[model samples]
Target: MVYQRARDQAELSAIQEAYHLVSKRMEGVPGLLGNELLRSAHDPSGLVVMSRWSDLAAFQAWEQGSEHRADTAPLRPYQDTRMEIPFGVYEVDAAY
Candidate 1:
């Protein structure tokens, strides 16, 4: 079970919009396992995503797909206010 985490900030409304897009559209895409959007209780502007894919390739394909691009278009306007500060990603090794 490999996971990818993307940390970004957006208005509650935009987060809601993006959330729907992923739930509806991403599920149909190949290689998607599941994903969720998490908001910081301390900071509304802080948004974190926990996504699982069949594997890294599947995740990369989704990232490069048009569905991801188009769905995220709505987030452009608020880039300044609702953007992640600096994020890090770590790999999870495969289990035996």
Candidate 2:
């Protein structure tokens, strides 16, 4: 998940646009199952781009690839800088 903050509605729109572009670029990418753009109910400026991959190995492979930075650059400026780490990776322990 990548945490993001949009100061206002205009910024939010831009973020959404960027998300869509990134999604398009990721189409058919190996191991990328799906992704979502989530906005906070309490704090409208708070946003998160969550992507599901087949496994850690797959995600790491893409992240380390040459196109990774360019593909995700659009949202870089909006990343939540307050947190020490603005992103995280997790494995499902249990799911219904």
Which candidate should be chosen as best, given TM-score against the real structure? Answer: 2
lDDT for each residue of candidate 2 in 1-96, tens digit (9 for 90 to 100): 999999988999999999999899889888999999999999888999999999999999999999999989999999988779999999999999
Off by over 4 Å in 2: none
Q: Give per-residue CA lDDT, model 1, range 22-51, as digits (tens).
A: 567555678877767666677655565666
- Residue-level lDDT for 47 in candidate 2: 95
Q: Give the Å shift of residue 56 in candidate 1.
A: 0.5
lDDT agreement of model 2 with the native: 0.94
Candidate 2 accuracy as TM-score: 0.95
Task: Give the Å error, residue 92, model 1.
Answer: 1.2
